[model samples]
Target chain A: MAGVRIALWDLPTRIVHWSLVVLIPFSWWSAENHDLERHRWSGYAILGLLVFRLIWGFVGSSTSRFASFLRGPRAVLAYARGSGDKRLGHNPMGGWSVVAMLALLVAQVGLGLFASDDDGLETGPLNHLVSYATAETLTELHELLFNVLAALIALHVATVLFYLFVRRDNLIAPMLGGSKQLDAEPAARPTMARPLRALAVAAVAFAIMAWISKGAPLAW
Target chain B: MRTRLIIGSVAAGLASVAMAQVPSVAEQVKARQAGMKSVGAAFKGLRDEMSGTPDAAAVKRHAAVLAGHSSKVGGWFGASAASAPGVTTAALPAIWTRNADFRKAASAFDVEARKTLALANAGDMAGVGGQLRALGGTCKGCHDDFKAKDD
Candidate 1:
């Protein structure tokens, strides 16, 4: 039997994910309640988390790379057929969902940086770049996307539950504990410490995200 | 729209005469001060009537004052938008390029302002708050797209 010996999540990656789970809802609540200061700061934190994840996915570990989980359409289709095939880490569908979620989040957070609440007391950091008409459209899009993300999240949770009950799989446990013991080889293991090279990459990505969230300075 | 523009221009001209040279920042400060004053007086009027029986005349007075001042507020910005470049203001390069969107937002504010006036005239305090909330939304809508954050 394949024992769960590898570490799937590094310290930084785990920290980023849990922080985001808390921050996203907090930011949304602040926005709705017209808590400008808290909303802006929460948004900054989200941007930081996203940036860190993007970097970590690249060079942190073997399983974290896009190449490992991002499969061809044919492979994805085969996996969907209940072929009893499994991935040690992210399966193809889950991988694509991750990409979609990241893209949507980036757009949402980016537009919010420039949003104004009309009361002179609140505005996004980059609101100065666009025309009022453009801002209106962006704001509307951002609001609509929130609903879309919520629906997607529900779907994702339902799928996980389906896997647990019907497929007899425990996907959530792996994510929580960063380990999965399977009776198979070629499975993903977690990383305890990210290499210095990976750390440097993560720092660069964080700087880029911070710069973008701050309205790229020159554009400001 | 044209009439409001004229009134705004006239008021702006008169306001400018009081100073040697009214900087854009100074003009903005003056406009904000006036807005605060008008809102304060209206809120006080609202509070005073809470203890009394429903008064139609008082309602009309409140509606008229709000509509007038709101229009002037719109005009103040409209005039400023028109005359901004003359005063060396780096308001945002996109503001001039995408003037149509700015105008649309301004027009939208005027439309909502009129709607609020109609509701107030009809003595529908029950509905005025909702309408005002929607009106406030449009203001943010425009600002998000066109205006830069306060420097």
Candidate 2:
């Protein structure tokens, strides 16, 4: 059925999503090739992006907010049963998937901060803060978690393909164009994303990243 | 006296024959590998020490060892050494294909290693740590471009 195209994603969210699409692979390549410096910096960028996303989830556009997408278990069950609310933002299952991915990414990046390799050449900036055993443990977790993330990413892509071909929902277009053509009026109408707020949030994220990179000194 | 002269000449010929049995390329590669292994061990030792009590003297010793190894790293990758295949090595063919870039990376690593050594000798653990990070970056840069991935 024909429907009006309404805004579904903000510019900042789209930028973050596409940038991640590029940077994630870049991170893997750098790590695989032993380009630890590039890998480390990519990780830092990911962390910063994640931080901005967390903040934007609250202060960003209507469709981008966590409150707009996250739903109760009942809603997810209903969606599974093919009887769910038609919404503009993420569906129930998709919402939870987003949450899961974000949580995993946070864990991965957090563990990386304390990780060290056997070569003794490359290490996290804050590796000195932890004991050798702790660093080693975190390093192991970091490696293992990447595999988990890779699997999840594969699943995510598969799901997106399913929506595109089977469900006839062009999810990629909405993400790229920041709007989706819907059958009915969007439940959550588009609102100003407040680019200034996003900028402020990004500044804070960068400051935190800079401090962490600088060994997170307690005092000046 | 003639018999004694013949025996001496035979012994000298046997020694030269034994030396020729070992190819020069193989010998060079072996020596280079040994030097790299020593550098790796020294780096590991430094990290282990830093992980514990941060001993300035021990760090200095290991850093000096690294610096010494770094200086010889360039000479180890001779022209013949790249083409000759004898022992198992992670060195990729690109090291020879991009000879100038590889040499630049090696030289950069040497500079960082020397800086790290000086910092360690000064007992400046913080400075040493910073230099170690840079040194590690240089090492990774070369490895990324030149070293083959372990399967």
Which candidate ranks first by lDDT, i.e. highest?
Answer: 2
TM-score of each: 0.57, 0.66
Q: Which candidate is the best by DockQ?
A: 2
CAPRI-wise, candidate 1 is incorrect
TM-score of candidate 2 versus the correct structure, residues matched by position: 0.66
Clashes of each: 10, 0
lDDT for each residue of candidate 2 in B93-136, tens digit (9 for 90 to 100): 88888989999999998998899998898899988766666887
CAPRI verdict (incorrect, acceptable, medium, high) for model 2: incorrect
Looking at candidate 2 chain A, the ten consecutive residues that score lowest on lDDT are A116-125
For B101-124, candidate 1 gives per-residue lDDT tens digits of 766776676677677668778888
TM-score of the second chain in each model?
0.52, 0.82
Residue pairs whose backbone atoms clash in candidate 2: none
lDDT of 2 at B122: 84
| Superposition error at A80 for model 1 (Å) | 1.2
Q: Write the per-residue lDDT of candidate 1 for residues A1-220, one digit (tens) a residue.
A: 5343556655566666668778878987987776879998898888878777777677766666677778898887887785645556677788788777777888888788766554533557666566545665676777778887777767878988998999798877767777666555454344444567667866787787778666677643
Q: What is the lDDT of residue B32 in candidate 1?
A: 55
